[model samples]
Target chain A: MSEAARKGMKPKKNRAGLWGIYLALALIYIWAFSGMNLPEIKPTAGQITKSIFNGMFHPDWDYVSDPGGEDLLHGLLDTLAIAALGTFISAVLCVPFAFWAAANMSKGKAASGTGKFVLSFIRTFPELVMAIMFIKAVGPGSFAGVLALGLHSIGMLGKLFSEEVENMDLGPTEALMATGANRFQILWFAVIPQVITGFLSYTLYRFEINVRSAAVLGVIGAGGIGTPLIFALTSRDWNRVGIILLGIIVMVTVIDLISGYLRRKIV
Target chain B: MMNQPIKTSIPKPPSKIKNYVTLLLVLFLLWGSSIQTDSSLAELVAGFPNMMDLLNQMVPPNWGYFDNITDAMLETIRMAVIGTTFGAILAIPIALFSASNLIQNIWVFYPIRFILNLIRTVPDLLLASIFVAIFGLGSLPGILALMVFSIGLIAKLTYESIEAIDPGPLEAMEAVGANKIQLIVFGVIPQVAAHFISYVLYTFEINVRAAAVLGLVGAGGIGLFYNKTLGFLEYDKTSSIIIYTLVAVLAIDYISTKLREKLL
Candidate 1:
């Protein structure tokens, strides 16, 4: 049965068709450019270079230690607090939802499949889009930022949790069930041990991502450092901008170092 | 020979009251967070209609505005392509250094991992903003930001995959008197190259989306246009930009996913 079908199967003659599309697109581009009489880009590289040095390199030392410094510090604190709270909430909520969504933990396919579809939809939209929507409803603040971060984290954590569940060893679970343990007892004794380290690693990793996301949620008026950052940059306050950048770099580097250390110890 | 069962001590189970107390504590925390955040269920319900109203405003999107955004849209894709390529090239050495199996010294791997972690900690928007502050607002800063962002992403994934690879080929290379560089070239790179490209393309897809939004921070690309249009409350133009972005992202994601499936 297999040999007959294998002989009958002919590779589709679609290779030329693919190249035909590419050629067509190239021609269209050329034609469009000629018709439009596209203007040549003559950007002044020297001007850009001068501006970079003036605005970026010659950072305002006075601003770094003055009112700009105070504003930047407050922004930094706000960003960190929101990120921390969001990560904590998401980790707590996502653990139980992940268990229900994971194939190995749920009793049947229906429950797991439904849980997964909901999470998938949540993941399809970016955090910015969610923040925009929440800001419209809740008004711009750290609360909206937290909600956006938490929802997005749920999707990420759920997927990671399912993977951890899928790759777990089944031997201990069978042994625990053989001892006449209830569902909860079996899960606690068998499943949690294998997945605890993985769960911790995933949470730490998400925390790193959350810190980054929270820093920018302010662009949409969801609150945090982004508001002040946008203000300083647009105002051409190079000194304040430099201070903000410095603060962000320091904070992110520290979070990275601590999370990295913890992850290594756990794993 | 004496055969005796090996026995391990098992602790007593926690009482039911303990479980209930833990549950109560969790509930308390949830309530506390909700109160602090002022997330009332009543507010959410009341706000549902506003969401519907916003959606209503966005519907029947102005298709004509698509033409206006075409150039910015193409630039965004171009930025992503260049950025992803640059990042992937840099990721190779960083990933090699970070892989536990490849780097025998704990010191080297730990430090390399620390750098990767730090790079990954900053969101694409924040990175773009910082770069813009340094480089001045333009496509160059956008590209640089995306390049750094993609490097962090690809290095993390590639190194994790590398650590999980079969060590047999590496052992054989070492047995053949290969130096460290030669051993990696012969033993490690080939096995992980396809997966590496898969990660690169996946990161490229993300970079495309991220680049589209970088303009919001004045870094460069289509996002600047987004900010401009949305600033004036030009919902029609905003809708057009969003539609174009969604279509481009979906198309790239489809192709990338297919390629990744084939490579892996």
Candidate 2:
């Protein structure tokens, strides 16, 4: 500053680091893109676009409101039910596990580590894989979907809940302990209250995600809209596919708005 | 003193009735939905036997199947890498445009955010299936789907972080009469680069997991094997695939999480 200001000259920017990063990123991009084995874009692009657009504009309304058959409405309801039940079951099951996983609550590194490992193991399996396994167990229906979503949600919700517990104000907990309250009583009166709102917020967020997942779980015969969606696509029933996609979009949007509002109100 | 205290005006604590009402409503909804979905403890109990049977069948995994699936697993990782890289590239401009603190114009940020939200609403599976239809069954479609998904996620996360960054440097750049591009390059980029890299890595982690299943929709990946083994009732091979995928995912997650910890 002293030298440059006195000379009335602007200092050069030190851009070597930035340039290096850009160079590395460029190399990575080239390597990765080349490895993808991308197929050549077919000349049928225009036809596919036109067909998709046409179907979108003319979604089968009968399928939209059909009450007597496996229509968009029925599929939407099933997806909603799956997400709700899954979120509820997981949210409930997460409590005890979250308590065990929270470093503060467990009060031992070994116990908390074991709990974290269990959660990580559970989380490693994608909901789709879990759904496939549960389909084998419960035999291809909404039950399998619910169980799969519920179990997967436990991994996510439990981790989040334990983090919340770990970060909570310990003053109240200590005060309760000082008052000669037992561990369970302190947990109920002190710990649970502080984290309940955060727990609810996470559950709602997971529910939103589960709704989207439930839509796709049906592809593997785990029940919900995915079954109809995959079937329509496979059979080249563009009109039906359009309706299903539209239903999914609308349902997801509505859930997003509601959950977003609730999260803001709570968190 | 007691009489004076009795006359003191203390505002009552807000009633917890609202909380209880919401809780009850949520509980009722869960109950009704459980009934509607035909999910119950009884059914779960009955399914336990089947679950055990499946688990028993999977205990001795077909380790020989590892050779067959190795290339597919590599393809899955490659797809994630390429897709995440492409998405990170696309996300830069979108995040810049959508960041309220950077863009300032409501119209610009709002429209971009709407588009991002709409993209995010489509689940990765649906996106993969759609791309498969458009591009035919291959890793190309899977790559495209992951790219789009990563774009939505990365842009959203990056833009939010961009908005939260300190405004002091940006203001200083403006005071120095720096041009718009110069201001951003010298100010915003430096601040957000670390966060952007962290977000990119996180997206890669998610994409790896997502890509593993993209094959289910014929978009190409390890999911193809999942479908094959499950269709053939070869739980042993399925278990092996699961184990391999789990190891890969866990390794990536650990590395990325550690990197993110350092960045933050």
Candidate 3:
């Protein structure tokens, strides 16, 4: 509309518009920060910081090697076990459901929709919530954590597996069908071979995530490092908390390395 | 004469032995882990009745509890919004520094990556617990925890995307004598902006779900009510909270997914 615009002259940078956005964002930050009621930094804040640093450097050696009940090592093992078992169980159990959920594989639209809906429902609850519910059912322990992780993983694994199934090369299946193979025969010879690698990759990936989840499940008494973590924090035992945190970091790192290596090798 | 007897050596399908051994090893590990964790079919079967009872109790959720939880739910969303926005803001620098393509010096990117990995290993629950200790109880601790969590996530995702970006603009910018900051601003940001926003929204979706449970450790959110209701064995009330959280999470997920689809 302007002669300069019509002549293709450069327009001014919308400085006002840019500033308005910045101001709005700043206001939002202020509102949110105010809602938090952040505690004023007291002199004790310095002491707390110092203690945290000290604890980080000097973790409780006794607790780290303690062979007694529910020590860091035992907690680490339990967490690993939960993650491993949960991933395995979910990978095994998701196969049927995945087939049911895959539109190309399922009997009809209704079956696929129902399968997907069930999975969505399963996935709705956070792992912690599921852990709590499982704790209520099975009593708080690593077993409950495993159950929680497994049940929650089914939703994810099923979805991933179904996608794999849906996108699979139809060549093999069509070939087998043309040879008058039965449904189960075709599935065994065609579907499983194509999706096995993807299924394993997804399961391994899920295991890595589950390890992290299992580490924190104990906060809800579902059982893991999280219980000791909360205990130490509550009672102000920063040294033990430091050790637990360290163990978790090491465990996660090692698991990630191994899983990453395996995934690369397989996939 | 008949074609010289075709000597076809079928390459023996590479070692079924190896495959069998790997399968066995995996199975063994699974069995051992199942025993160690005390997770077995029998236990699950035994717990079926209790699970049924819990589900039975959860039906007919206490609708009245919705009024009480509205504020907490809003606080949770606000916490996620603030946490994710702050995290995304902070992540830009870290992601820039950590990206191997952006920072040619291995030393610079390596240490940044180590820090990112270390940060990511700490679960949000653990972060909240530590923050709650320092901040005293409230949504402040939850916000801080989510912020740290988001930083690790967004940075990791963003740096990976940054590494995969087209190098043409970056090289062109450099050839034009653009400074490091200028190159990033004009070249890098334009290329990665969509991906970065998508990562931020994805992280926000996770944060919303995570925020709902931060209250378990006194970090503040609907999880406080979750703890309270469950402590009182008020399954009906707990069910309502779960329902509300489900709705919020699903809505956020849907919107974020749509936004991401548009972006990419």
Best candidate, DockQ: 3
Write the candidate numbers in order of decreasing DockQ: 3, 2, 1
Candidate 3 clashing pairs, residues 3+ apart or interchain: none
Checking candidate 1 for backbone clashes, the offending pairs are: none
Question: What's the iRMSD of model 1?
Answer: 5.0
- How far off is residue A52 in model 3, in Å? 1.6
Question: Against the true structure, what is model 2's DockQ?
Answer: 0.59
Instruction: For residues A1-267, write the lDDT of model 3, one tens digit per residue.
Output: 989778776666779977996897698677777777555654466687678778888999789767577688888988898999988888889988998999998889999999998888788788888999998888989899998898899999999999999999999999999999998899899988999999999999999999999999988898777888888888988898888889999999999999999999988
Writing each residue's lDDT as its tens digit, candidate 3 over B113-211 gives 999999999999889988888877888788889999999999999999999999998898899899998989999998999999999989999999999
**Root-mean-square deviation (CA) per prediction:** 7.9, 3.7, 3.5
Give each prediction's DockQ, rounded to 2 decimals: 0.19, 0.59, 0.66
| TM-score for candidate 2, residues paired by index | 0.91
For candidate 1, give the lDDT of residue A252.
Answer: 80
Query: Which 10 consecutive positions of candidate 2 chain A have the poorest summed lDDT?
Result: A29-38
Tell me the fnat of candidate 1: 0.18
In terms of lDDT, the poorest run of 10 residues in model 1 chain B is B29-38
TM-score (C-alpha, index-matched) for candidate 3: 0.92
Looking at model 3 chain B, report the run of 10 residues with the lowest lDDT sum: B6-15
lDDT of 1 by residue, B107-199 (tens): 999998888876776678877876675566678778889999999999999999999888998888788889998888878888888889889
Backbone clashes per model, in order? 0, 0, 0
